[model samples]
Target: MASNISYKCPTCGAEIFWSAEKGCFDCIYCGDTFTLEQMKEAGAVVDQPIDEQKVEHAEEIVDGEYTQTTDGTVSKDLVKYSCSHCGAEIITDRSTAATICVYCGNAVIMSEQIIADFAPDYVIPFKVQKNKVMEAFKEFSKKPLTPKDFDCDKVVDKMQGVYIPFWLYSGKCDGRIEGEGINKKTYRRGDYEITEKRIHDIMRDGTVNFEMVPVDGSAKTEDAAMDSIEPYDFKDLVKFTPAYLSGFLAERFDEDADKCFPRAQERIENTTRSELEDSAAYDELDIKSYQKKTTIEKTEYAMLPTWLLYTTYKEEKFFFAMNGQTGKFIGNLPISKVKLVLYSLLGGIGGTVVGALLGMILG
Candidate 1:
């Protein structure tokens, strides 16, 4: 049977969760904070490895039938674990690493999912607290053309801190670019115009070494949205510990490293080609041929922090995401047709009044 784990305050016996503001686990009831080393010393952080034989046996039994509850049949992909705090049954898909129990609102970490080969090598814990994220989101939704009926408070209430899984790739790229550089000159001599044109063959070649090129490991996350929140500062990364996942929701990698390598490769190749082209330094460069090769040196699995929310306006869903480390927010807001028309009418009226005043002055 899969087991659930929740960090508990040693003094108050209440559930403790990671606090972004405090940079440690905090007890809401006792107003106490505990660091990673303190928790480990208290015996609160213990590894619970799943037994492979039992897991294989359970898989065989639940193969086709899944597990039928008294109420109804559950999907084969979904697994159920009892929440340690509330004893309420928590059901989640294979990709879910941690979640909050709906009944009691206590954080629950599925121990078996994040142990052994599935564990992440590094984690960037949430640095921006929920209140900070809320403030930033309010500023983001302050566009004049936004729909008045859209409730920012409601979306803010639904915001969740998630540790998104990513694959970090490091490699070296070598490439060459061959192009034609053209120069043109024009002058007037003795009342006669003369034009000169020169073309020269240019070739540039170089190598670029890159580290920590990130590609998200969740299929549900949009590639474009993930790309927009680029350039996470990898210097802040800490060794992965379950203590860091105490409060926030986390997802295991559904798409493995092999599946995500192509994206990293594409990014590296494009960067290498651009570097070579820049080195050529021509007024006008037309590329005739480009060739490159990438060799991956290292690949690591990591969990990065993000604040995410979803809301629907006029039946169209909108997604908001923020970089938990840097607080960079990104999302699309709905435009109010009424406001648009009003602004257009006001502008037209003002323009006509200005034109009439100019005509009177000229007459």
Candidate 2:
């Protein structure tokens, strides 16, 4: 077992925790505060992932599952941290990430643990407060079609602030597009209406550049749910610092940056094709063929803030996510069937009334 890492107050010799509200690490005992730079000067190091793929001894294992030995000899790759509040032995696979203490209810930072390359180039700190998240969740539950028990403590208590891994990709897409379109001319000829139809070949070519396109690098998170809460304003992004992770959980990238390129490639190619189509004016357009080539310019790893709520319905898990920085919320929620039917019936009646009103006006 590895020794636990603690950030002691340089002035008081007491342990400290990161304060999200204050944007620094503070000692609960002596009331001393330290910034990331100050903490590094005080012997605190960056936290990094201990990938099972990279470590020959530490194999991947699910959470809550551990290896037990009779004689008590353990793998060199496994590390342990003890909670100061509860004294529970918190064991983590050499995956090198530490989260909240299950024994006590406080965030644990394994400072002495060896941090690695999964370290981010940038980080967006959490802007939304915990109370605000609970308030927003209450508002979200007010939707007419959601389950009635969404507000229960069993469902609402599990909300967490996690810094999710993202790979930023920037590239330029160059392409040529050739298609067919129709041009129409209509004019009045005395008492007769004259119409002319002309078909023309459309050819377009251009170079389109995309910057800071993000792809989630964590395998545990669903891609679509992560993407749904996007438009993370990059203006607030700052240099990656471990001080920002005081009360929150952050996961290291499980996959490489190059592995994320296919998604970015598809996104740029689709955008390039759309841009080409917008260049032509047509009454009717038919796209025949378009070919594009993509060149990736830059790739970097980073962490973004997210508020996640997990609940189980009929023994199956469900997740709701909100962008911690921008407050965009999305979830795969259970729908109320009675409410759905009622809403459908109301919509049908409303549509029919509007149709009757339009007919009366036109006739």
In order, what lDDT does every prediction score? 0.76, 0.69
Clash pairs (backbone) in predicted model 1: none
- Tell me, by TM-score, which candidate is best: 1
lDDT of 2 by residue, 75-140 (tens): 344455566557776666443344666666556644432245655788888877777887877766
Indicate the worst ten consecutive residues by lDDT in candidate 1: 53-62
Candidate 1 residue-wise lDDT, 1-363, digit = tens: 345566688778888988999888889999988887787777775334445443311122244443322112244576667776677767666667888777888877766667777789899988899999898888878866678888898877878888888999998999999989887788999999898878899998999999989999987676777777766899889888776787788887889899999999999999999998888766778899988999999999899998888677898777778888888767776767787668667784354644443232210
lDDT accuracy of residue 243 in candidate 1: 68
Clashes of 1: 0
Kindly provide the TM-score of model 2 when superposed on the true structure, using C-alpha atoms: 0.75
